[model samples]
Target: MKLLLYITLPTILFAFYSCKKGEVAEVKQYSKLKVTVTNQYKQPVSGFTISLKTGSRSISKVSESDIYTASYEAGGYTLTINKTGFIDFTEKIQLNADELKEMQIVLKAGEAYLKLNSDSILRLPSSSLSSIVKIQSNTKWITKDTSDWIEISKAEAFGDDEFYVQTKANLSDSIRSSTIKILAGDHEQQVVITQYPPIRIKKTIGIPGNVMTQTPSSIKIEFNQPVILNNLQSLYYYCISGTPLQPVVDSNILSFNYSCGELGGEYPFSISVKNTIGDTFAETINVGFYLQQLHFKGNIVTHFVNDKDNSFWLLMENPDILYKIDMRSLKIIKEYPLFTNARMITVNPYNDKIYIGYSGVAALYILNPDFTYKTIPIKLDSTRLKYNQYEELTPELYPVNLVFTKSGIGLLSLSYNGDVGNSRFWFIDAAHGHKTWYTNAEEMEWYPYTMDVNYDQSKIIFTNYSLQYFTVFDSKTMAFNKVYSKNTWNQGDITVASRKDANVYFQQVYYQSVVNIETGSNTNATLDALDAARFDFDYGQKNKIVGFRSWNGYVEVLDFTNSQTPIAYHYYRFFNSITNTLDGKYIITAAENGNGDSWVSQFPGEWFREEATQSSGNTLLKIKQYPSLIRKSQWR
Candidate 1:
């Protein structure tokens, strides 16, 4: 058994081991996160709260400077930044282990400013009163001002509010101003307060012109405050001695009447005004009293305005004298004497040459710009000449109207001793004064009282005073185009509204009618307070709105675009010719006023509006009288 045990020792050996429980330490890994914040102006922001949140954990800290730093386990986190006056920010982030992450953020400003519901400048009158100043803010606000004239009711307020700005009466001679500062947090707004003087001169009426001749006998002075004239008559001094001066005070207006007899030179005058508050003001002006009344030997039949040289051509009837007047100085520049009375006058748009029609002449007078004249015989049927009782041939037909086309072609409408059966019309070459085409006697049942051409110079329109026929013809080929008749026993004038308008306007005794050329439809409307109305062909040739005058002294405007409605109305002593300037800025009229004096008054064209009542106060220029027909350089 011993020998066997020694041989099997390796197979029966026993080992002893001990079992013990021990703890294993774990080293946590971390990631670094840095955040920097700035304002919209790129300035660093401080004191902002920075917070980080994870699945079940969160960390928060106030930022001491613009940058904040923290260390956390590698994971996803929601980062937040908040401030009192700045908008809040939030973001989700993922960080890797042992990695440094940097972030930059810009903060937008919140709605925490002050605003004023007023303009930068606040105007105040010379009166003791309180004005409301509206203030809008989201936080507390304070106001500061250094002025003795103004007092603020509320010096501080919270949020939106209104305060009273008290101002004392401005008794100083000059205007005063002050500034008010409104502060909310670090923002500031300012408003300027302006106070006007107690009393001051505002304006002067009836004395707008620089020349005394252009002013009426009565003048008015206006003041900011009610006035008490100290010395009425002694306030004015005229250049001419022994001139009468009378004044009257009516509230803020000091009206005065002055008379200077036969004074035709420059007059120097002064006006001194005193208000009830003991404020005084004076004005010295130099005005000319020169006026020339043109006493022609005969009546002015027609006139033309050459705007190129600012010259006005007047044609006299008895002696047929053509006078060129300087419109600026109102002086006669040159004169050309003719043989007989002239009926109509016109200016060639292309060459500026003047054309004249005579009352009883068979020739056309062509006057050059140099004041020289020539005549071309008008081709007439010698067999149609009529002999009077004394066996002498009667005078040739009178060319009552004449017009030129854009291509320098002339169209003349003729009447024989006011006879309706012997009416004739002629087309002439304006350059060569040659008869291109014409209508024989008895071609028309009535004389054409008025004529007009389209803007393109393609069609000719004519009508008779009998109110029975309306005719149109081709201007180039002299071909008949159309005709219309009404057979109404009334007198009227014809006008073509505009090239854009397809209707022809007819001004009758008591009504106005518009007829469409294409459809042949007629629209009629009775004019109120009008009698024997007549249209101004010169104005309505190309204008949609036309001027008209009535025998009852009514001056009115008719708008073709508005179904022939009467827009404006004015009364005159005797309305003659009415025309608009080529620029369409002024309406010039040749008529007499209530003072029994003739005048060519100019009014602002814009003053003519719907239901607008006007007076002489609206006159821009009151050119003294000459009973003559006037026209502008350019009609269309």
Candidate 2:
């Protein structure tokens, strides 16, 4: 009995000791764990809130920095870390008591969207119908909440899947960069935003002759605000009127002087606009002009001349005569007569002959090619043959915008015909003496800003300043082909670069645009803050439109090679001089009269210049250039 009792007591004691040791070991074996979160760049990520759960039991710890320390009972667990605009990170953590554990996590920044090919909606020329780029495809521009985007593009391609495009761009101002899993639809070819280029724009009045031939000069670009040239390499520029390469000059200003040397014509230039930001606009001016020796008299003599001297042709309104005068000698070297009465005059390609039209006649004269005889009237009237007794028709009138063709054989005229109680174009065939083609309209669809014929007469483009429409027609048929219209185009001049490809530049008051017409699906740029007008683009200077000039009494030239903005070129304040001529270098602004009135600046004796310097005395025709002498030898 004593032996049995001793054995049982030893067994019980051993069992109690084993149970106490097991509890002690459990308390010492489990440990707390510390973790740190970071980005792929190794930058510490902060404000990572982590939520932990075990069989419906849950706890949360949000860290000020990326590091966190938490105690865990011996168990298997799941952890989730979250931040704004960042992907939530999840990890499986195994823990124990009495020991330290370490873990590292990484979160990535995010991206936003894909670049849409807006050409489908905007320009989308007829040729791109095969690409199958549909509308509303790239309109998704936002990212998922709490997740950062690293790129916006195709991520996976499995067996025979079409080539998919990918975007790897990030935004710092709105969100962080992110790397995401992506898949593309089955498209055989992929298109991506390989480059984002800024837009280039220009606008100007196309040379008058360019309309007949469909050739233009550099497009003088005018913007509503300053042009934002964000990317230099992304821009592709072309002049619509002036020289093509010259559209972008040494200055940032766009200039196109296409063909100034063409004889017997007048030309103007302007710009069109585009950009990667989906910016697009056109010039406000339909026609731009460069006034030379603009005599304030109603019978003004504005002539197109070579810069070297004043040797050029003059448009005389009094008798409706076009004269080729020698700048060196004030002699009427040659005279070209016209019909009705003259109001405005212009030449083709800066040629030897001239063109004159009457203010109330539907006639445009094609002068003799040799400068000896006057151009005969080929399209004659039938002497008010048939008419309604109740309807009285007035004579046709010609606007003051025109140009000559290179051959000097054709004269392009933009005549205002109210005889039919409507506005229409009268294409006079000089060779056949008949109306060749016409675009008739009952209302004034477009008030002519300027008229231009290209050097080849293949394209005909015009701007109706009041209508804000750019009408491109077939030069041969006078048939409408295309219309460049939308909001943001100001009423101004029109011009073309006369190129076959997208190298077309045009502008208005709103912006400038440059593009290859061959791939002309979208505008190349959009700039802002500029005022361009008809009195800006002068294409006779080799089709290159030097920038706009202001009429501040002095000459205001702009150098636009440095930027989309313009810089002052030359300024000359004129002293009121009556005896001094305003044109031919030595313009005869001074005419004797005053208490003696001969029309110019009321003066007496031989003739004197007007003196604005001395206001209180006799109104003497005074000038500061010649001091007190008559500028007799300076007419040219």
Candidate 3:
């Protein structure tokens, strides 16, 4: 009995020791990990989810806590902490057996932010005394003013805030700027403010009391202060009864002069001055005068010059009288009675003879330089006439427009019953009287309202009135080349460029388009709509095109050399008729005086020369002296 009791006790003791050894080995393989989440302010962040992962298995069951405690096996493990407003924190950790690791995690506050409604502000010289600014920030922010001129109403604010920025009336002629710096915690933002000097037109001096036949030498305007001359082109605009002039700035003074040939009337003028920040001051002035009369009567249809006597011939329509006046003295030189229905006149560039077309009779009156006149009969192709079969009446074709080639061949556009579609175009040999080539009436719906020839005379463009298309003909062979159907409306006038393979069409309703003769494509040519009533090409110069805006009484001069925009524009009285000299040195406009009488005036082409000088990098003063030279020379 004593031997059995000793063996059983030893077995129980060995079993107890083995169980204790297994428990110690198991505890050594695991580590205790604690994770704590806090904000940037070091405050406790609750409701944060904690995850402890090993391989593909989740070792932690606790999802949310400010402090998460977990036991993980030794070696590499992943620990993740997540919160609503804070960025997620994830990290890999090496677990040490039986070691307690406390990890402090910092969460950034997403609600703390600073922003400004606008980064910058512009204050005009004439602006009101104060400006309002809006601020967007969730945290408390402080404002600091960097300049004496700018005053902020609010220095400290929380959440979105409104601030009043105050500035004194800018008295100086210079621009000023300031900044307001906003600080929200560590975030810094800025608001910029700018102020411009006040713009003022003090007074005008040297205004002409009486503008006779000659233009005033100089008209000067003084400003309250000197201003920057950038974009000076839009600074001032003036309108005359007959001509237009551009203003020149010298320091604070604005001065301009006109030539002697412009008609006498109340010359209405306006001046607007602006500062760098678009503050404007404007004034209007009117100067009136009277001039001696030339004793002319009736509406003038055309104005031509007799090179022999250096006189201008005014062709009157109602009285059918041609009055010759000396250009220098503006005195009547002679008066010649013309055909009762004389309509159009042109000088033959090939020969110095003048050809006048009469609508009443199918004939052209040829006037020699010696003032001797002769008549040439125009025979119409009877087959092309649309006549009534029952009546013996032959429809007489009236001459409406005329064009001459470089070879002195005259192409006359004649209409029957004032219908353009059924009209005929006849080319006459200027050296003789007979017609050379007449467009076939059956195959051609072309009614030539206006005609233009290319520089090399390779193409002749005929603008149709009734038809939707204009005809392009081979100038040498007089054969049909191509029909430009892009111009849907037939009312627009056509002008072909002498230098480039392009033609400009001015639509009466709206817009002007350029057609590429080579590609047969159209593109916009003008920035604004133009009046089709009167337009002229600078033929000799081949660089500029002038169009009259009758509705607004403004003349737009387009320089093809500068493709972006019109080079020059001037305001004038509404003119019914406009024609430029062959040399393009002068522009003549005629308008009825609302009475029975009509007035004719001349404008020097040098008005646009200022823009040309600016493009060439020359001073405006250099071309100011050209008005007198342009007035003295006879352009036609």
Candidate 4:
């Protein structure tokens, strides 16, 4: 029965068997994945390899044709495509058994090369325009400006285009520069831009050429462009002769309101003006002054021979050297060395001979006009020397203060060995070279530091240091007429000036008092707080007294007719001595340099008085003028 059934096979079975035998078919557990690669421009990409990966297993031997085919198992697979000049493509794919899947991939081209129209750029700081930078590239580009002053109108753009780079106005004096970077994918280009500094023009200063009747109120300067106010101080200078003046600046105008001094002459000055950017402009100008200057090699203690030619004999201390200076040429014609420990020098008005009193010896050195000299010993009366302790009866006469009368009589305040028993005031006949009388018999321990003769040479006003007393002596008889004790008048290092009214004005320390020489009555004068150690007084007409604070470099003018408050007070540097011409038309101040040299400055008395009157009520003027005066008076 089984044989008969097998022989009679079904037609469907026979057809299935014949089809399987002729095709040799096998069941597949994988799928075919087709990957097609194209560029961003939609063009086919060749020479690319496609990798099929699953877990840690991968098949990367599949090369790219028109389409890339890879047999992947029925699971999740990762497809990685790589090619030159294109961005690699990667994707995850899912395949079913015996299923055919196609994947379309687009590749991005590599970074495009970027080109700039110019690699370097230059512009002026005054330029207000923006610069346009053109880029030649196919890829999208971006720009970055590193500086805040530098601006980019278009920071990023697609493809090649023109970008704007702008800059603000550069107000600075220095040059400024910046760099801009243009980036396109991996390619980059840089543009360097530099801006030059602004231009500055020279300015002109207008100065008055005429003689200044008063202090200049203002000085104007014209400029082509606006300038910085702070920079003006460093750019301009004002000088009289060679002395510098500190001027206040208000915009382009400079002002000076203090007294310019009484010197009368042509004052040549130079101005070196510069801009904020260091551009310099020079100008030389001359202005007339009412005063003159005479330089000396040493500190001038006394001067004689006031003439039109300005020739004078000067007595200097600290080595005892004498000099004859010719003011016209400002030269020292002659100098003489006096080998003596002298404290005071005086010129005999009758014979014009020089007399120097010694502090170490009881002698006087007489110097002639031809430089010849002789020493005369001072003789003390042994009968009157009762308090003298020396064994020789002739003690060392230390003459500290000396004053000569018009009749060639010398009043010397002397001390013997600085002892209390031998201090005296002596009278000597300067013309005869002999000591006539002395106060040794009347007073003991009287150390006189200063002595002054009255205008008529009738009275001598003497002040003592150790024993505080002011004594008045009869010039003819050498007798003590009156004595002011320390309890009544506590003054030291006194200076005396006789007025035309027979009134004596005296200053000791900071106290000023007026005494009636006829009656010996004193009235205290108003005085400012003076802290100086040395002071000098010059009494002019109209009850005006000019006081010089030597150590502090201050000049104070007091009008006795007015209140005690100083009418004019000014401060200067290196001011040591003060003097006035005999005619009282000018006031001269002596300033010492660091080199031990000195300069004489003359100022108009009338101008100074007028300025003081004008500035009396203006507190602002006082405050402003004081500092400027001090600054200008400093040595260069």
Top candidate (lDDT): 1
Could you tell me the C-alpha RMSD of candidate 4 in Å? 28.2
Q: Which model is ahead, 3 or 4, in terms of lDDT? A: 3
Question: Which residue pairs collide, candidate 3?
Answer: none
Residue-by-residue lDDT tens digits, candidate 1, 1-636: 999998777555531112233644467889998888999899999999988899788888998899988888888987778788775665668988999999999877785667998676787777887888898886667789999999999988877898889999997766689999997656798989987676665654332121212332345566776667655433223323233456777887777654331122223456566554455666664332222223355555656656566565677655567887665455679888876767778776646677787766766678876666787666665554555557876543556676676666666665555342344566666666455455563433345666666545456677766565566766566565545524254555555443344567766554556676667767554554234344442231343444433344334444434434333232323444454444444444444333323433444444343222212222211123212212222110
lDDT of 1 at 246: 68
Worst 10 residues of 2 by lDDT: 603-612
Which prediction has more favorable lDDT, 2 or 4? Answer: 4
| Model 4: residue 546 alpha-carbon error in angstroms | 6.8
Model 4 alpha-carbon miss at residue 560, Å: 1.9
Candidate 2 per-residue lDDT, tens place, 214-241, comes to 2332334433223433222102122122
Candidate 3: Cα lDDT at 93: 81
- The candidate maximizing TM-score is 4
Q: What would the per-residue lDDT of candidate 4 be over residues 29-90, giving only the tens digit for each residue?
A: 88888877788788888888777788899887646474777677788886667667765565
lDDT against the true structure, each candidate: 0.59, 0.38, 0.57, 0.56
